[model samples]
Target: MNQVTNHTECSSLNNAKVAIIGAGVAGSTIALRFAELGINTTLIEKGPSLVNGPPICHLHAGGNLYREISDQQCLTLLQQSIDTVKVYPQCVNVRPTVVALPLTDKGEPQDLLPRLEMLRDKYKALVQQNPSNEVLGDPQHYFRLFERADLERIAQRELPKKALCDEDWLVAFAKQVNFDKLKFPLVLVQEYGLSAFRFAAIVSLAIERLPACTLQTNSRVIDISAKENGAGWQVTTAVNNDDRVNTAHYDYVINACGFKSGELDDMLKAKRQRMVEFKAAYVAHWPQCQGLWPEVVFYGDRGTPQGMAQLTPYPDGYFQLHGMTQAITLFEDGLVASCEQSAQPKLPARFIKKIDHHWPEQLVNDRTIGNIAHIAQFIPDFTQAITAAKPLFGAQQIPGDDPDLRAADVSFHESGYARAEIVKASSALAAADAILEDLLESGLVTSALSKRYLNEHYFPVSLQCQADEVTARAEQLAQERNYPIALANIF
Candidate 1:
């Protein structure tokens, strides 16, 4: 345990102590952010080291667009992602991403025009709102439209010889790449292909170096309970490989344990139901690409079982080819007992039974083969691409690794624990913001000073603007409707 720094005992903080369970990217980011605010923070991880856990390499900046999110929210998230790179440049690899639209029988790219135009309009609107926003330089420059001939030229120069010249291969590949489907192919610059392991390592290092923060590896939080007097929390942790149980008290607790957050939430009497789902994908690491292939995402057709296939290049001369299939839902009833039992000092029989019921150990090989076949459409070499073919969950212990886990679980319950989903590393920023806002309103810290700190250090320019706009819009809407405003309703 590291000695607490005197600076952490600031009057505004009222000698606040925060314990963040799980040292994944989300927890680590929050730990570092809180430490920077001169708060005494502790980051606990069940694993021996941060990088020893699950693999999460893909990172989306502005390139990977989602229809579900509002344009303003998307831009805000993108800016936060970019800001992450700015803060830790050495931990990421910035690269241009190419999203290939399907081609029609007439050899035209399908849906390219509408998609590109939509993006252009969206970018234009963002720039119109903030003329001086230079985070993403000129939107036109970054979002380039490439013609069929240009794409052919690029393929000829970059694709493998067999893929470039073979008529049969070309015909099969053409079905996947429709030049006539769209006016032109779209290219997005400033998107990053991150090394997840490296990013986690850097964050872990930063947390350890903070004088007011402590990094406790191999410490698994078994239970968290609110103090009887409601002043703080009592967190009980079971140290791995040691028959010992240690308990600590804190003013705040954040459950960034990724999948197992729901289990931790239960300990605090937070009864939110978290639905679990599993998607299997295999990653093939090729020694080298035939040509200068940047990160490529092949959009699946309507009938395709797999949703999409993404090829991400690493600086280490290897590409991670991923094929995402439709998710398999894990029934909520199946997980309740297991999740609850896992939080106890001793593991329950029902918990082990439940884990075996849902574990995908039998389908590992088949899932890997299926993923390889799906991705092989674009990269023919992917059919024979060298890969471990291990179940992704096999990379780390399953429900046993952390019992209360779920896929991309981010839920804020009445309990003090803020569960941050770790699917995208950038999710940490959102989680930290939520936690900070709660603290501000609780008067643990002065709102004005905290807001200044957030804006100056953590919040991106786009996010700041978006927050203000959302607030104003919500207020206006509330006045118009003669009702009180809620952030959720506004969004």
Candidate 2:
């Protein structure tokens, strides 16, 4: 087994070797944290690039999921995430936009208005009680309530005319849309549109620069087993496009591979009762969309095939439309049939045919057409705009990537192992904190040294310095190669 040692000022973790599987946001964040803590950390990724899967459209920093469940820890993590991202201003596009949720008039037993009102009241009281709290910033700036009049005023200038004419449309569908028993629609602030690939690239580049970090791209972990002596773990990996196999020993391993973690270890498989297949498509070259737009979430009416749709704009004049569907049984013969059955009325036959012909291995791409069709109902121009647009990327169903994953009970199979299935990017900070706490409690590292390491590396100065360095390197390479340094080229 190949063992690596860290030669840093923090000697407590100098001999500690850790391996993090996968290089998505969660995995990358954990690897960065460990690397910054002077541990001999290795980030293993199977893809050619670090961030190779479906694009992450936006970053929800204002406690969107936490506010729903009233989780105080989640809320604190959300704030830390926002602050961490702000340190890299050049890599991310931080925009102030209201996330508008249009209330539908479709008959449903549950009263959504009162629920929203109660939530608003709860947050309002929190703000009033602790005006100086960092997690719950100024409530007036963070939370907003948009009445019918405000919606109408914004619709006139923002929404297409055809959307207003269609009562069934999702956004600004009717002139007098009713929010039964409520004064108006609710909006959340501090939402930002992020270039997912760029953000990941920045972090990956920073990880590579760390003296204690080893980024092994194109390396797939084939097997991981406990050492014969029960002291650590022996990980066997197969390097892509190569016949040679390598083995490494690490004191700890973090499975941050999202849905793919199950493939590495049976114990890590998500025991989800039901799995919802979420799909999305990248639609680009929409001339109508000139600048940034709000991250819109159109709630689905009960009993309707419509579940939920998210429209997030990108800096490159492109947008992503995604949503969830009925549960699917993956790796089974009926997987395709189940996806087709759930994506009806929204997904067009042409789109489904495209997925069947091009990417049959994917279960979520089949729903891309349905998601686009659903979005077109509200934005009439969407249908026409899509004709000129092209499909850029997509991802299949991911278990444990849901908003509720954080609320689930956490259990570890091994003593020196941890799994960070952080579904939301904002939860990355909290996930790192949890892993460090576990390591300290498990006697893997000293508590005083761990705390000091965390305090020094939580918001590392290296990340802030890398922004300009990466930008300069990218621009230099673009100039040397005589190619454009646009977002598309760099990402």
Candidate 3:
């Protein structure tokens, strides 16, 4: 294997190894893909667990939240979201989201109709191609409409003790929302919630059981160098509690560090353009609220005083809130871009400290309280809600300068190296497939293995990891992270 630059030189797929750095959503998904094909994979993570980088609450099935992104991006997101659910079905929470436009919003509620109809048609087509793709529900019932008159009828009725249908999900929300402040025909889309804790449980547990994969958490890659005349890569990693470093050889290395991706590029002596943004979501407790409620979004201008406000509900009356305004989620100088000298985006030191460890108690209280107040404007009763705990926060890497870019795929520059830089978690599988394609093109994988993988869509390895384990581990993770146990479960 010495001085082997060409991938074709490898005789056996079992012997050819891959090293992946930073086990976030993208890294974890890519590792799972390679391991399924019987390729030796080593997933190295700087953190103690995989997929722990950021808060992933919403499924973003239709990309309906962003009115700015192109319809093509929305369609791409819809397809990728279906792929994500097929692989990790336990992670999805079967809930609809109520999308509303406040009076202060610049766009009209009618403006959403065209895009919503398009999404419906696209979803129907996908389901027709393969019935399993109907993860969002029947395409005919993908969206439900509500007018001021409909709200009046539901607002006065008693909230259902046990929610069963879309009407039941709307009872609590209809009673709380301010009718005077919104436009006509509120749109309720079939977008769902994703439990990050359960997702982490599935990824970590599945990777451990795979004989071809070795998940090395708390091991940071210190250095990467060419092994003797640029044959392969020598990756040196520092174990968490060890004084000495351990090094390993690999035929290919993929860098999937979410926001710290540029640091890896710098190590490889490659200066590439990218942008990173730091964001967080607040958790609030509202015990007095009645019945199950759908996730709610009140659209407003981003980064302004009246930025968009999102309300997501968990079991046992725990609600997660996100205010796009600077006073809540956005921070001063929180967004940074790579320069010609360095590829790493330099965020404020305090943010880095919070990401490395945890946020200050006072800062957490301030942000969470501010978020409650923001939501209380629309849901007046939400003023009674109190701060839950530390906010779920992290940094995200965007491929280009467009701040609103929601879809990004893999980038391959070096012959033997690939960068899995996906903007959204839904894009994880797409990025992994892109990398797998590169391996096939380079003759690192055989046609037989590809055919074997093709038949196993909605993968079989995932079936071995049971939902009961996901439930227990998710509850444990929520408790250990200082969040309510109910946050880990679906409504």
Candidate 4:
């Protein structure tokens, strides 16, 4: 169990309360920022503190999981805004990987070889500027272009023999999986300096840091509605493993739940157009192979770099590899759309075929040994350490070169999602916009700076229904109840 401490309460909002559903990175970060600004806030999470999967895409990975709209610079500014709200230094860290793009079906190098050569040289120059070896925002460390020969040699010499590994194992180890000339996102978070965990710790730490913020794990929000006085919103939760129900009221309610955003949308009567869902994978790893991984690798052959899986270093010398897809518009309650493969992608089909063909036999006998041995094939680091290993889940012993992989049973902590292609602002930025728009229309918050920030930070309003209608109704409801419903004056 983790312990969180609260600080002195503030007098802002005259103690008016705010409710934020979901305790992931976005929710908790927002809550911390609000609390720091003297807003009384409560952050509600429906599950345990952390899951053994990947973190959100944006914080760690360089890619945006939402639509990639125009005005990409605003997107950076928005993230910087969230980082400002962070009580701790940015816990998320990204590492770079070399990606190969295919030029032809016959696997011949693309005619754009000269262009790629230039890019590779440019990338090397970038790395020289910032040599952290971790890929966060450092543009130089994000990605590099590699040639066909670079990949072919890696495949033939590093990958495991077909007879010894599972298909997935082979594909992953060989680096034969197509990861087009795409930039993948990777993140690392820490509980304390040098004590790294995944995104969950970051959220938990934020909640603990809040003075009066409550983080109820395993508590589910079953119902929510408007308060009678227009004072705020009322929320109900089922806790104690959903056996008990409790209700609370707050002056404002924020829906930051990821996939569950739609449920809150329904409760608030928010337009269905305001909610969207994209498909992502929750990836876990098999036991670690002895030996330190070389630079983590990513492979996705889909044309246009929809997404790619990459290896991320974990504490105690362990590593996690996961993949993500690009986010497309999802219909209400509809499945996330898949992407089409690139016309000429660099995915190594022969390598995949070899792995798939041999996987069944390996699985039939000595599955554990087979998985490790398979990974060892492509990763020279792992291959060198395969001998004299016991069947254990966590790392029993750490190799000299890798201090992070010494533990047994490391948690799975990688996540990827389909990203929105349009360059758009983050949700926080969007909220800022909503607030400004409300103020502008209501004639309450009128300031040049405020408007500038709103314009600069605001993402394209994507809500399907009329924003005007919703704003009007909310104002009317506030007026009837005598609360500060003049939300159009939110600034």
Instruction: Tell how far residue 312 is off in model 4, in angstroms.
Output: 2.5
Cα lDDT computed for each candidate against the true fold? 0.53, 0.53, 0.85, 0.35
- Tens digits of per-residue lDDT, candidate 2, 1-491, equal 11123324444563678888888777777777776676678899987556544445455553452234444544444455454554444455544343344444342323343433453455566556645333333444454556567565655554443322221122433232334422245454445555555555567567766777888888999888888899888999999889989999999898776545555555333233212222335443355553235556555532245545556655444556654333211111211211222311223444445433443534443444555666665555555444223333422323333434333212355688776655556565566777877877777776366677654344353455455566665455434433234432221
lDDT of 4 at 454: 43
- Which candidate gets the maximum TM-score versus the true structure? 3
Q: How far is candidate 3 from the true structure (C-alpha RMSD, Å)?
A: 4.6
Candidate 2 RMSD to the real structure:
8.5
| TM-score of every candidate relative to the true structure | 0.70, 0.71, 0.95, 0.48
Candidate 3 ranges beyond 4 A from true positions: 1-13, 452-458
Model 2, poorest ten-residue lDDT window? 328-337
Per-residue lDDT of candidate 4, residues 1-491 (tens digit): 11211122122224555676765444654555455434566777776553211122233122222112123432343333243223223333322233322222222233323433443344345347545322233333233334445444445554443323112122233453343432222211111111113233444444455564666667778888776665456789988444789998765566655434545545554433221222222212334442222234333332222233334433233333333323211112222211132111122343233222322433223433333343333343443322121111110111112212111111111110011111111233334334335434543334443444443421111111233443454345334423233211111
lDDT of 4 at 89: 30
The regions of model 1 sitting more than 4 angstroms off are 1-14, 51-54, 63-73, 103-138, 155-190, 301-306, 326-366, 388-411, 447-449, 458-491
Residues 200-240 of candidate 1 have per-residue lDDT tens digits of 54565455556767888889888788899887789888988
Error of 2 at 221 (Å): 1.4
**Candidate number with the higher TM-score (2 or 4):** 2
Clashes in each model (backbone N, CA, C under 3 Å)?
19, 2, 0, 41
**Looking at model 3, which ten-residue stretch has the lowest summed lDDT?**
2-11
RMSD of each: 12.8, 8.5, 4.6, 17.9
Positional deviation of residue 122's Cα in model 1 after best superposition, in angstroms: 5.7
